[model samples]
Target chain A: MNPMNYVILAAILFSIGSAAVLLRRNAIVAFMGVELMLNAANLALVAFSRIHGELNGQIMAFFVMVVAAAEVVVGLAIIIAVFRARQSISLDEPAELKG
Target chain B: MQSLIWLAIALPLASAAVLLLAGRRADAWGHWVGVAASGAAFLVGFFALIEMLGKPAEERALDTTLYTFIPGSDLQVDVGLLADPLSITFVLLITFVGTLIHVYSVAYMEHDKDRRRFFAYLNLFVAAMLLLVLADSYLLLFVGWEGVGLASYLLIGFWNHKPEYATAANKAFVVNRIGDIGLIIAMGIMFTTFGALDFATVGQLAGNASTTTLTAIGLALLLAACGKSAQFPLQSWLGDAMAGPTPVSALIHAATMVTAGVYLIVRSAPIFNGAPDAQVVVAIVGAITLTLGALIGMAKDDIKKALAASTMSQIGYMMLAAGLGPIGYAFAIFHLVTHGFFKAGMFLGAGSVMHAMNDQVDMRRFGALKGAMVVTWVTFGLGWLAILGVPPFSGFWSKDKIIESAFVGEGWQPWVFGLTALIGAGLTAFYMSRLFFMTFHGKARWTDEVHPHESPALMTVPMIILAVGSAFLGLFLAVGDRFSHFLEPVTGHVEHHEPVLPVPVIMAATLILVAAGAVFAWLKYGRAEVAEEAPAGSLATITARNDFFQDSVNRAVFQRPGQHVTRTLVYADAAIVDGAVNKQARGWASIGEASRKVQNGQVRSYAATMLVGLVIVVAVIVVGGL
Candidate 1:
C-alpha cells in the first residue's frame, strides 16, 4: 500500500532495540540490540527512497548493511574478550569507567 | 680652633670604640686610654673656648658643617657643630668634669671585673654629652640625645646580674622615651613651620610664627626638659638611676646630662620669649620639682638617693631660671656650671664613703666618718656649703640671682615663684645639712666589723679640684659682672630690673632662712641619735619616703589602660580577622562537597545527564522554529 507503513515498522523495530540495549545486563545481548537498531535505520532509508521515487536512498541503505555486518564482527570479538577476562560479559561487571 | 670642636667629641668616641671592639685584649690599658681621651678632649675644648673668647661677642658663633643629613628633600638639615659662648661653656663643663670622673673610676672600679666596659660606657657618655651641646641642628642634637640615653641605660644596668638594677635601667629608659616623644613632636612642628631644623633658622623665623605654634613648641620642649632634668613627675627615675655606679651618678646625672634640659630652654629663648604662657608653665614645673625633690630628699635613708633628690632640686632652679627669658639665661648657665662642680664633687664624695663602708648605701649605717675619711668629709662640706648658697660659694652668686629674678616678675607671679624659690632654698639647706650631719656627725651606727677609711688618691684628687672650684668659682665668675658680660652675646642684653624687694633685703632674707634651716637640721639629725632602722611615720613622711607615690600614679594612669587596650585588640584580631578567612574557606569546601555528589562513579547517571542535555537542545531549536 503506502511506503510510510515500512517507515513505521522500522521505527517500532528501533524502539525495541533501544529498550533491549538499555535494560539488558549482558554485553552480548546489548551488542545484538545495537545491530538490530542499525538494520532498522537501513530499512527506513530504503522506504524513504521508494517514497521519493529515487535510487539514492536505496544505495545508502546497501552501504549501511555492509558497515553493520563488519561492525557485528568487531563487536562480537570484544564481547568474547570481556567474557574471557572477567568470566562474565555483563555491562555492570565492567563498570570501571563509572564515576 | 673652631674646627677643633669635632676633636672634643671624636677623641672620647674613638677611645670608646677601641675599648669596646678590642674586648678583653684592651682591658688592661682601657681605663688609662679612657682617662687620656677625656683629658685630651678637655684640652681641645679648653683651647676652643679660648679661641671663641678671643673673638668679638657678635662673631663668637662659628658653625662647621659635617654632612647633609637628609639629601634631596624639601626639609633642610645638616649634621653640623656650633661653637659659641653657650656651647663652649657646656663643653668646658662636660670635658673637665668627665675627665675627673674617668680618673676617679680608674680607682673606683679597680676591683670590678667589668671595669673596661664601664670605662667604655663613660667615654661614650662624655662624647654624646659634648655632641648634645655642640650640635647646630635639632636633628643632630637628637642623635646625641639618644646616644647619651643609650649610654645611660647601659651604665645604669652595668650590674645587670641584679634584677632590681635591670628594672631600674628599664625605668630610666622608658621615662626618657616619654620626653623624647615631646622632642620629636617639637621637631616635627618646627619642620612644618620653618622648613628647617637648624637653630639659626628657627631662632630667626620664630617671630613670624603664631603664638599658638610657638607655645606648642615651647611646651613640648619643656616636657623634654622635665624628662631629662628629673623635674616633677619624671623625677621618679633619678632616685633609681643611682643604681648605676657612683661615678655615673657624678658624671651623667649631676655634671652633664641632667643639665641638658636647661641648655635646651636657654637655647630656644626666642620661642619662650614669644610664648609667655609656656614660660609660666616651665617656671611652675621647676617650682614643684624643687619642692618635691627637697621633701623626698629629706626622707631618704640612702646616701646616693638623697644626693639624687638634691640634684633634682638644683636642676629645678636652673629650669626656673631658664624659663625667665634672657633675664635668667645667663644665671641659669652660671648656676649650671657651678652646680656641675659641686654636685659631681658631692656624688664622688658619696662614692668615697661607700668605698670605705663596703659599698653600703644607707646613710643610717654611717656615723662619725669625718675622722676617718678626711678628704671626703672636707670636700663634701665645701659642696654642702656651695649648695646651701653660703657666702662666696658658687651657689650664692648664681642661685641668689635666680631667686632675685623670680621676684622681679609682675603681680602674683612674683609672689608665687619668689616664695617657692625662697622655700626651695630653705628646704635645700635643711636637707643638705641633714645629709652632711647624719653621715659624719651622728653617733656611730655600724658594727665593730666595719672599718671606715679615706678613698684612695685617685678619687680624692678630683674631689679636691671640684671642692676648690665649688669654693671660689662663684666669686671668680661674678666679679666685675664679667660672667654676665661673657654670656650676653648668646642671651642678648638683659635690662637691669630691680627685684620686688631691695637686693640687700632679699639677700639678707635668704641668708637668715638658710641659717634657720641649718639650725633645724642640726637639732634633728646632727645632735639627735639616728636609729639604724627607719621609722614608719605619718602620711607626709610616708608619702615623701615613697617618692610621693609616683609609681602608683603612673601605673593607674597609663599601665592599666594600656593592658586593656592590648587585650581587646588581640581578641578582635582572633575573632574577627581570623574568623572571616576561616569562613570563606569553609564555604568553598562545602560547595566542593556538594558538587562531588554528582560524580559518584555511575555511568547510568552520566548517560541520563547527556540525554537531558540533548532534549533541552532539541526543545530550544523547536521553539525557535515555531
Candidate 2:
C-alpha cells in the first residue's frame, strides 16, 4: 500500500476509536478506545515520516507511545478503583460529577 | 530672650509628647508633669516679657529664626518666633493662665481614669496656642491654629461614651471649618499681595495694598475671627462646646483659643486701618453678636452654657474695640486679658458647683448653694461683679474703654454702635445676675440626695487667683494708658484726644443701667422659685431660649438641602455606576453557566462534545479547500 493509504487507514482508525469512546458506557472499553486512538496517531506519524524522508515525525511517534503507556497505567488504576468501589466499571455510574 | 523664646512653646510640647508616649504607665502622676511643664513655660514667658519691657520702645519688636520651616527653590519659610509687643503680651497671657488651668484640671480630672490623656491634650493645646500668637509667619500661625482646634475637639469629646458630647464636638469642628476657609483664603491673598508670609513684612506692606485687596483680606480675617471667638453666626457652638470638662471650657474661652481671634484682629491692625469699609463691617458684626449673646444668655438655666454665652458677648466687646481704628486696639486686648481672668474664674466656679451638685448643670436646681460652697460662691461672686462692669473691677476698666471707643467715630456710626454696646452691657448684667442669683440666692431647690460643698484646694486656689486678677487687672493695665503705650510699637501711634463722651458720664450711665438690670433679675428670679424646665412664655422668651432659633435656621438653610443632594448622588452611584459593572459580571456569569453545562463530568459526554467540535473544524477545512 502507498504511504497516503497508510495515513488514510490511521485516520479511519482514529475516528473509529473516537466513536468507541463517545459511544461506550464501560470505563475499560473507553480506556481501550483511547489507547487505540493514540496508536492510530503514532501509525500516521510514522507513515508521514517515511514519506517525507525525515526522522522528526517518527521521533514524535516514539514520545507519543511513551505518553500512551503512562496513560494506560494511570487510567487502569482509576478504572480498577471505580470497579472496586461500586462493583461496576460503567462510566455512566460515575456521573455523580454532573453539572 | 530671643534665643529662649522656643522654650515657651517647646516645654509644654515636650510634656505633651512624654505624657502621650508614656501612656498608662504615667497615669498616676502624669498630671503633675503637665502642671510643672506649663509652670516652667510661664516662667520663661515671664522672663521674656520682662526682657521685652526693659528694652526701649524702638527695640522691643524682635524676630528670631530657629530653623528653616519650608525651604524650596523660590519660596522659603522660617520656623521663627516674634517676641514683639503684641506676641509677648499673648505669650504672658497664654502661659500664665495656661499654668493655672493646668493646675485646676489636676484636681478637676482627678477622679477620671484617663487623666494622663487629658493632661497631655491640655499641654498640647497650650503649646499650640503659644505657637499661634508667637509665630512670625501666617503659615506657622495656621499650624498652631489647627492644632488647638484638634486638641479642643478631642477634649470636648473626651467623655466619648456619651453620644451627645461627641456630636457637640463634631458640631464645633464642622462650624469652625467654615471660618477656617476664610482664614486660608485670607492667607492666600496676603501671600500673593505681599510675596511673603512673615507678619512683620506683611504688616509693613499692608498700608500700600489697594483698598479692595485690603477689604477682602480684612473680611476674610473677620470671618475666621468670628469662628474662633464665637461671634454672631458662629456663636452657637460656644454654648454646645460647654460639653467638655470645665477646665477645657475655661482654657478655650480665656487665654488659649477664643482670645486668638481678638489677637488676630489687633495684630493685623494695619490691614483693618487701611480698609475703612471692612472695619465698619467688623464693628457691625461685633455689635450684633454681643447683643445676640446677651439676649441668649438670659434664657439659659445651664450654668456653663450661660457662662459660655457671656464669654461670647465679652469677646464681642473686644471685637468691637478692635474694629475701631487705632483708638481701640489696645483696649480690645485689655478687655481680652481682663475677660480671660473673670471668665475662667466663673467657669471654674461653675465646675465647682457641678462637682458639688453631682454634675447638675441647671441653676434652678442649684439654689441655696452660697452657704455650702463658700469659696466657689465668693470667687464666682467676684467674677460676676467683674463681668457686670462694677467699679474697680477688671470689666469696668476694660469694657468701659471699649464702650467709649465705640462712640469715637463721628455722627450716626457712633450713635448706632455706642447705643448697641450700651444696651448689650445692660443685658450682660441682667443674665449674669440671673445666673448668680438663681444658683445661690433662692430657697433650697436641690433634691434630698444632693449636698453642695466646695471644690478641693487645687481647684479653689486657681479660682481665687483668677478672682484677684478680675478685681485688679483692668486698673493695673489701664493706668496712664500704659497698656496702650506698650502696644504702640505694633499698633502705631494711637491719638489721645479729648473724650467724645465724658468718662465720668459714661461710667455713671453704664453703672446705672447695669444696676437696673441686676435689680430686675433679682426681682424676677432671686425671690421666686425656678422650675427645672423653663415655663413656656412670650415669643421673645422662647426665641431667646432657642438661641434665636439659629440652629433650626441652619438646619433649614443648609442641612436639609445638603441631605437631599447627598441622597440623590448615592442613588445615582448605586444604580448607574454599580449597575454597569454588575451587568457585565452577570453577562459573563450567564455565559459561564451555559459553558458549565458542557462539563457534565461524564467521560462519554465530554468525548461526544470533543468529537462534535472536531467534525465542525474538519468540515470547515474541507469545504474551504474545495
Candidate 3:
C-alpha cells in the first residue's frame, strides 16, 4: 500500500476511536474506545515502518499490544470496584473530581 | 596567615553553633562561649592590626582572593578578605566592644530564661559584623550586611513574646531593606560598569570610569549608607529599636550596625571622591541628620530614646566627615570608635537605671540616685562628657578634628560642620544634663512600688571599661602621626589643608555656650529649690513631659499611616479580595447543588450528553480534515 493510503486508514480509525471515547457514558464502552485508539496508533506505526523498511516499528507494535492487554485488565478491575461502590458504571458518575 | 584570618570569622560562628545545639542547658556555657569567642576574635583583630601596621606600604597592598562567591559573566564577586588599616580598626572595635557587651549581657540577662538564644544571637551579630568589615568584595560585604540585618532582626525580636518588640524588629528590618535596595542597585551598576564586585577591582575601575557611572554607583552607595547609618529620613527606626533588650540596642544602635553605613562610605571612599556630586548629597543628608537628631533628642523624655537620637546625631557627624573625603575618613572613623564607647556606655548605663528602677524608663520617675548608684552615675557622667565633646573627653578630640577638616576643606563644609556641631554640642549638653539631673540630682521621684538601686558588677564593669575608653580613646588620634601612619595604607594620601585655627577656636569658645546651657538646665530642672518651686502647670514641664511634641508628630505621620495600611490589608482580605474568592467558591458549590437535582441518578440525560459530544468530535474531524 502507498504511504498516503496507510495514513488515511490510520486517521479514520483514530477519529472513530476518539468519537467512541467521547460518546460513551458506560465504562465498558470507554474501555473499548481506549483499546481502539491503541490499535489505531499501532496500525499507523506498522504501516509507516513498512514503507520505510524498518523492523523497529513492528517491535514497538508488539510492546503496545502487550501493554494494552495489561491496561484493559487494570481498567476492568477499577470499573468493577466503581460499579460495586456506586451501582453504576457510567463515566459521568465517576467525574467527582472535575473542576 | 589565611588560617588566622579564617579563624577570625570562624570562632564566633563556632560559638553560635555550640550555643544553639546545646540549647538551654548551655546557657551558662553559652555566655562563657560568647565571651571566649569574642575574646579570640578580638585577639585576631589585634593581630591583624599588628600585621597591617607592621607591613611596609608596598607589602600592605596585598589583596588575597579567598574564592569566588558568585560566578556571573560580568558580575563576579569573590569571597575575599582585606586586612587594611581601616578594616583592622573596625574589626578591633567590633570584637573589643562585642566582647564587653557579651560580658555585660551575662549579668544583664542573667534573669532571663532563654539566655542561650540571647548569647547565640549576640555572637552571631558580632561574627556577621566582622564579616561585613572584613569582606573584600561588595557582594561579600552585602552578605555580611544582610547577615547583620538578620541578626539585628533576631536580636531585636529576641523577646518575641512582646508584640511591640516584634513590631519594632519588623520596622527595622523593612526600613533597612529599603537601603539594601540601594546596595543591590550599586552591585548591579558595578557589575555593568566594571564587570566585577571586588572592591579593589571596582576601585580601580571607578578611578578611570566616566563621571556618570561613578556618580550612579556613588549615589546608590550613599543611599545604602544613609539607611544603615540611620541618617535623616530613615532615622525613626532607631528610636523605636529601644524596645529591644538594652544590650542589643547598645550593640546595634551604638557600636556595630549603625556604624556599618560609615564603614561602607569609608570603604568606598574612592567612589565617593571620584563623584563629588554624590559626596555633596552625602554631606547634605548628614547635615540634616545632625540637626534633626539633635532637635529630636532635646524633646525626648525616655532616657534610652534620647540617647538613641543622640547616637543618630553623632553618626551624622561621622557621615559628614566621610562626605568631606579621605582626610575626613580618618576623623570619621576616629569619632566612630570614640562614639561607640561612649554611646554603648550611655545605653548600658541607661539599662542599669531601667533595671534598678524595676523597668521604669521615664526620666520623671527617677531622682537622687547619685549616692546609690555611684558606679552608674560616674560611668554615665563620663559617657555624657565624652558625647558632649567636653574638653579632654574622647568625643571632643574626634569631633574637633571633623569640624577642623570641614573648615579647612573645600566647599561650604566648614560652615555646615561648625554650625551643626556647635548647636548639636549645646543640645547634647542640655539634654544630657537634663537626663543627669532628672536621674541623680534632685529628690527621689519614684513611688512606693518602684525601688532604685545599682546594677550588678557584671553590668558596672563594662560600663567602667567603656567609661575609661570614652575618657581616653580620643588621645589615640592625638599621637601625632602614629594613627595616620598606621591607617595611611587604607586612607591613602589625604589632602591636608592649612589648619583652620579660627574655627577650632570658635568651636572651643562654643563650649562656654554649652556650659551656659547646662547651667540653665540646672537652674530650671536640677536645683533642689527649683524642683520644689516649679508648678506642674508650667509650659516647659508640659513640653518636656510630652517629649517636645515629637510624640504627636510620630503618631500623626508614621503611626497613623502604619495603622491605615494594616487596616486596609485586613479589610481587603476579609471583605473584598478574600470575599470574592469565597463567593466564587460558594457560587460553584450552589451551582453544583442545582445541577445535582437534575442528576436524579438518571442515565438518559448522560446518554444524551455523550451523544452530543460524540457528534461534535466526529463532525469537527470530518469537516476540518477535509
Name the best candidate (by TM-score). 2
* Clash pairs for candidate 1: A99-B601
Q: Docking category for candidate 2?
A: medium
* DockQ list for all candidates: 0.21, 0.62, 0.05
Q: Rank by lDDT, descending?
A: 1, 2, 3
The C-alpha stretches of model 1 lying farther than 4 A from their native spots are: A1-99, B585-626
User: Least lDDT summed over 10 consecutive residues: which range in candidate 3 chain B?
Assistant: B528-537
Q: Give the per-residue lDDT digits (tens) of candidate 1, residues B1-626.
A: 78878999999999999999999998899999999999999999898878878888899899999888788669757889999889999999999999999999999999998899999999999999899999998989989889999999999999999999999999999999999998999999999999899999999999999999999999999989988888877888888999999999999988899889999999999889999999999988988988899999999999999999999999999988888778999998999999999999999999999999999988888988999989999999999999999998988998999999999879898888888899889999999999999898889898667899988999999999999999999999999878888888789997899888898988888999899999999999999988889988899999998999999998888889988999999999888999899999999999988887787554445545765786699799999895
Error of 1 at B369 (Å): 0.5
Quote each prediction's TM-score.
0.85, 0.89, 0.78
Worst 10 residues of 1 chain B by lDDT: B599-608
lDDT-better candidate, 1 vs 3? 1
- Cα deviation at A20, candidate 2, in Å, is 2.7
Query: Which residues of candidate 3, in runs, are more than 4 Å off?
Result: A1-99, B1-3, B499-504, B528-626
Q: Is candidate 1 or 2 superior in DockQ?
A: 2
For TM-score, candidate 1 versus 3, the one ahead is 1
- Stretches off by above 4 angstroms in model 2 are A1-3, A46-78, A95-99, B20-27, B67-71, B74-78, B110-114, B188-213, B355-359, B365-378, B438-456, B497-508, B522-535, B608-626
Task: Give the backbone clash total of model 1.
Answer: 1
RMSD of 3: 9.0
Candidate 3 lDDT tens digits, B507-542: 766677679778877876688442332356567546
